[model samples]
Target: MSQWFQYDRRIFKYFNYLLVIQIIPLLAISSYLINEINPLLFKKQMLYYGIGAIAFLVTTFIPWRKLIWWFAPLFYTMNLLLLLAVDLVGKTILGAQRWIEIPGTGLTMQPSEFVKVSVIMMLAYLISKKPPLEQGYGLVGFIKLSLVILIPFLLIAKEPDLGTALVLLITGYGILFVIGINWKIWLVLAVAVGLSAPVLFSHLHDYQKKRITDFLGQPSYPVHQALIAIGSGGVEGKDKDEATQTQLKFLPISSIDFIFAYLGERLGFHGMVTVIILYILLILHLFYIAIRN
Candidate 1:
């Protein structure tokens, strides 16, 4: 018991309190927004918050650095198998077949979400084993790294969860960009992507293609409504009675993807700026910590 207590104390001694402090304001604002929009969802969000806190605490107890080399590959393989299982027996939610339902619990888990963590761990493990040279990774190294990212990218994109898949793809490359990849390799990849754009577009689902078309041309239905919500708010914003776009359900999917529109309508330009600044600060802080460590 004394040894366990010492271990806990040692972990706490190096805990990053500043990171936790920065996250609190964001969580507080989200809770307030959810509470105002729907009291029931707010209650559920609180429960999720509790689960997240416990998860964070549990993760802190893990000896990550010590075990990462051996554990990462096993973890990554397990997640990949789970991703494959989704194709055979995944649950469909709102047109996307991206979740696996747990037996008898009426609960579904999204393997793509877990894939993000495993990918990062696998990347860390691989990179640590064969770090970049001063000129950065050569063709062989780059291909190995790209395969780590692209395998999962293809799987998730096959799920037609393009948004999440693209985010993962971008983030994976972004890490490579920071860690160092050969500049010639990047130029070649860019040219290759440009040449293949049409082929890629041809493979996308109709709705996904429509989204691209709408984005490049006119705004889509939900987007147009979101614009109205924002425009109606002006510079100062509107009262609860006046914010009819969200209040009267004109703003489509206001609780999820379009919550930013709801935020703009509720608090206008200044609020948007404030939230953006907070996000910038959080991102910059993270970058600083990553570079420092």
Candidate 2:
């Protein structure tokens, strides 16, 4: 245990540093914008951020491999249960049944996020356990790994979290490739994916289909609103009052997924560039550790 701690000290240090460098500036910018628009919302965002940071730090300090291996099945099961629970009793927000409210705690949980990390960890473990590609067992191992990944992929896709489910599929395929899945199999899957796109599109909900169609410039208010936000940001963006109003009124999803757009509007080109560089550095550092391990 002590040796594990000693070995991970450097990793923990870098993780904290990366968190501070990447998150603090983003939070500061977000808080500033939020404060300008709505002080109460800004305070709530900060409190949520603080709680999330503490949870993140705790997870980082623990040995991920041990946690994954020890609790992978339990974690996976719990998340599945939560996802089911959400379907039965979850709060509806923005037309998605992706969040569940916990009574007494007054907190909403997003089970899909937990599922993402669980899937990644499980994949990592399975890949680590497998023999080299030269071994005769590689094909069988690959099939088993595919099953492990596909189950959650289908479940989350059912939740209709297209973006995250796609991310999971990509990351799973990436891990399999890293563990030496044959290129021929990848080619087959690529062809299958290509063939299935039309069918997949047909299966999507009306709004989901519209989002894709709108991306292709089919008529849609959502698309127009998004374009307006982008256009308003301009090459250098609007002045402070304009930026604040744009956020408060115009920019939908200003706090979460579209936070980058908000950052671009207020901080302009230089700030966006800085944020990208910081992310690149942090990702490189994480990759370095993964490779070293």
Candidate 3:
């Protein structure tokens, strides 16, 4: 018992506890929403949460700074190869081939997600070696970094997982913004992207185009129902049966995509504001830590 007490795995040193805490509201809200949808799913989500906690603990055990430089390149190379393999042999669901089945696990995984992690790691490794100049990265430096970002962005977008691709692109650029990019370079890129918008729109996949069309043409049935759910809540929420949008199941995927709407319908305007405040606090805490360190 004494030995166990003396042995510190340094759990507290591993991750930002406040960051972990910040996620609790989202987890609680998700679990509650799933419970409302089906009690079994809530239980499954709890089990997944437990598994995720174990995964997080395991990840913290890694000697990230020491091995990340060596591994990031290898990991990124493999990520790109897997993405290429997906293009040829990936399993298609809906209309996109973005997943590969794990051999014998009967489980599927998206390679695009792996690309995102590897890119972040790889960028950190790259940038730390050659920190940005005072004015920011020059022309040559900018292209090198852009290549690192754009390769995976284009590959993932080709998988037609445009949403995830865009997210990864934004995250990479957001990091650049923090690290500092030449103001002139940013301006030039912005103008180029703006000019290319029409051409890019023309190249979008049919379903992707249809999604945009649907957004412009008519509100989706789900969106319309979600609006009703939000509008009905007013200042204070109604009783369970009186929450017709959720209770009558008019608000589709209330537990997932339209969860904000479900939250409003069940808890009212105040609850929504409270959740928003918590998220804002979390963001401020992250910014505080960033600045302090």
Candidate 4:
């Protein structure tokens, strides 16, 4: 019992309470906005928060430094296997086969989401084992790391989840960039991607291509409604019942993807600015923590 207390003290000694504080407001706002839209979803969101809190507490007790060497690779492989399983027996929703349904439960899980964290941990573990040199990683080292990212990118893209795949690809490469990469390799990559752009575009699903075209041409229906919601909010926003855009269901998925639109409608320009500022501060604080560590 005493040893446990000492371990807890040691963990708390370096805990970044400010980071938790920053996140609380965002979570609270999200819950409030979601509740306003759908009570059922709000309840599920709260349940998720509870589960996350439990996960956080459990992770606090883990000796990550000791276990990460093996655990990171194991976790990455498991997630990859799950991604592969999605192709075999995955559930489809909204035209994307990115979920695996749990047996005897009406709940589905997305391996792609878990893969994001695993990939980061795997990269960290690998990088710690073999760091870059003064001029950065050479061609051989670069290809090895690139494969770690590309394999998952291909799998997720095959699921037709291009957005998430691109995000993972960018994030993985961005981390490598920060760690250091040979300039020649980057130049070659740039040229290669440019040359492959046409082939990549051709391979995109029709809806995905249409989405790109819509972005370049004009705003889609949802985007248009989101804009209207923001514009209507003006400087001071409206009351809960008065935010007609979201209240009347004009803004699609107002509680989920378009929550920001609802926020704008409810709080107006000042509210939006405040949320943006908070997010900026949180991001800057994260960077500070990363650099310090």
CA shift of 151, model 4, Å: 1.2
lDDT of each: 0.87, 0.71, 0.85, 0.90
Q: Per-residue lDDT for 1-293 in model 2, tens only?
A: 66444346666556546546666665676687677656776776767888987886666556766566667767767777777777688787887777888788666777888888777777766666655556332556778888877877777777667777788888887777876766667778789989999998898888788777777877566445555665567677666677753546666666565666666676677767877887787778778867887
Model 3 RMSD in angstroms = 4.1
lDDT of 3: 0.85
List model 4 lDDT by residue over 180-287, tens digit each: 999999999899999999998998999999889989999999899999999999999999999999878899989878999999998899989989999999999999
lDDT tens digits, residue span 69-155, model 1: 789999999999998999999999888899998798555679999999888889989999999999999999998998999999999
The predicted structure with the larger lDDT, 1 or 3, is 1
Reference-based TM-score of each model: 0.88, 0.79, 0.82, 0.92
Candidate RMSDs in Å, in order, are 2.6, 3.8, 4.1, 2.4
Top candidate when judged by TM-score against the true structure = 4
Steric collisions counted per model: 0, 0, 0, 0
Task: Give the poorly placed runs of model 3, Cα more than 4 Å off.
Answer: 1-15, 38-44, 88-95, 103-107, 210-218, 238-249
Judge candidate 4 against the unseen true structure and give its global Cα lDDT, from 0 to 1.
Answer: 0.90
Please give the distance, in angstroms, between residue 262's alpha carbon in candidate 3 and its true position after superposition: 1.9
Model 4, residue 167: distance off in Å is 1.2
lDDT of 4 at 112: 95
